[model samples]
Target: MAGILAWFWNERFWLPHNVTWADLQSTEEAAFPQAEDLYLAFPLAFCIFMIRLLFERFIAKPCALGLKVQANGPQKAQPNAILEKVFTAITKQPDEKRLEGLSKQLDWDVRSIQRWFRQRRNQEKPSTLTKFCESMWRFTFYLYIFTYGVRFLKKAPWLWNTRQCWNGYPYQDFGIMFTHHIVTVTLITFSYVTNLTRVGTLTLCLHDAADVVLEAAKMANYCKCQKLSDLLFLTFAIVFIVSRLGIYPLWILNTTLFELYEALGNFPALWVFNILLVILQILHCFWSYLIIKAAYKAIAKGKAGKWNPLHVAKDDRSDIESSSDEEETVPRSKAPHSSISTNGTGGANGTNGYLTGGTCSEEH
Candidate 1:
């Protein structure tokens, strides 16, 4: 509770007009969580998680339905009582050794145990509608926060002059900007940790990258490095666009299709990070395909992609493995595809697991 309060209200008291670093550290000065204190994140994150749950239940889900985005599939896995108990007791992600122990104790083979776990995960995965709601929540938050930040600082004397950012060099810290930096980082980290994704991994990382760069750059600007800050914000904006729209579909889609063969040639010695990067790239392509299709529709028919998937609800899309849901449909055609599908199936991208089902031939 204290941590949750801090996430929202701490900044107000901690950083006031013309506040300095010493004001933060000096017990004789201002009040609140001490400067440099970071232990508050755990409770704050937990509270955010709980808030997400409540919002999804009461707010996001209802909105999704109104938008006509219903996720269809088996609601839950009918695992045995023992399986259910174990599933609830253990962490969602278990290490191999623990999984092995569970397999033996449950008198099940490793493969069966793995399958059960996968199904359980699928059951817990949010519906596409729910995901849309979650996104709306974030969009609302970021838009508000960014707007407020700009409004608050736009006319400041420092903003008009580049020299203000670098006046005192690197050691300076403006209380408000400092507080903003911490809060922004906490929010982004919270978002990343809360999401359950396999293919969306790279997108998340890229988002983190873009957000961190922008925030840090702002901090530098506050610290008197306006020139450097401008460069960073510009860079951040470009990367965000490219990563979200351009590279995600065009570049990543192409890379996933062509790079797999190159990767396989040295499969035994493949770079771990490179492999992870490839997997993430494929996932980005999967999600962004909807946006791409929407763009195509708008171009072809005059309107699309703004809110179709959440509202139209015809793709039968796979929320977990996008291939499974198919909530919206686009023209199917032969194009290069990736090995990973929205549902971890090969059919969408190829005909076999880890193979391009139709090689980007068609999409939903």
Candidate 2:
């Protein structure tokens, strides 16, 4: 396969040159200046090329198979299509009326319309899995570019100097550390008060989980601050979990168990303590909700930042179209209204007279 490809490439670009194959081989030997070196390097280069070709053909090809092709050879479609499809499906329904309308509008069969809806429903959205994988791949590619490309550009002083600042921070700043601490403590406290220790613990765990992702993202840029962030998150998780679940629970259980041996006269205090414990547990649950909400917002904003405005516009358009379709299918009804009137003259004097209102007015 390599020979075939090489032959095609030779014919396409090399054979047109006046140089003969023997002359090219001689030139290659001259450039290396050592037969043993040439022998080793030639086979190594060939093996590397073969591996890369196989990877592109087998792995990358399969992964990209379902992506839409562009006009210029096979390329993935613009990101807007995926976003549009999701929003469109969400805004519109697969009702008989809307499906029939779509069928008539597109000149497709009603069965085909139904099939299309099913296909769309079955088709996966741009899931977190795919997005995460793609981002990692891009980050890996950028790392390579920064590593080797920087070394190559070093020969050109201007280019090297221009990109010198590509290096990221060595350590996370105090601000980030402080924020993490605040968030962890606040979430823990909230969880304890709301009686949602489990949920709060999960929230803390997610913060730790996000550190892994954030570290990977920083690694793409060859940033060393990732370790600091990782350590901070890990510390927060450990401290929060141990304190809330371990230490606190142990203390409560020990007190309650010991109090069982106390006199019945102390029962009222024990009951009050139990009540407070329940309240604390409830507060902890509320705290957990806040933590989850905050984490979700943070991740969502980060992802949203990467999306193109054009993609967002496409999503908005799909939503509008879907909403319009739904409105067309839905039956409209008038809302009931009330009315009132006032007489110019008073009933028995020169005062103004009042007429009973519609629904608001009641008979004596």
The CA lDDT of each predicted structure is 0.42, 0.33
Candidate 1 lDDT tens digits, 1-364: 9899666444333222343334434343333234234455566667767876887789866765665555463245554687677778883534556655665566554434444554565676555454555555554445445655556546544344323432332223333432222333432333222111111232333344344444443333323344564455446545555765575555433433444334223322123334555565565456455445544664577432122322112323323322342332221222234212222233344421122111111211
lDDT of 2 by residue, 64-179 (tens): 44332111221122233533464386733355455445444555444333333333432333322233334344334334433443354345332323222111111101111111
The numbered model that scores best in lDDT is 1
lDDT of 1: 0.42
Query: What's the distance in Å from true for residue 77, model 1?
Result: 5.3
- List candidate 1 segments past 4 Å from native: 1-35, 71-121, 169-173, 178-364
Runs in model 2 lying further than 4 Å from the true structure: 1-18, 26-28, 31-119, 156-364
Q: For model 2, what is the alpha-carbon lDDT of residue 236?
A: 35
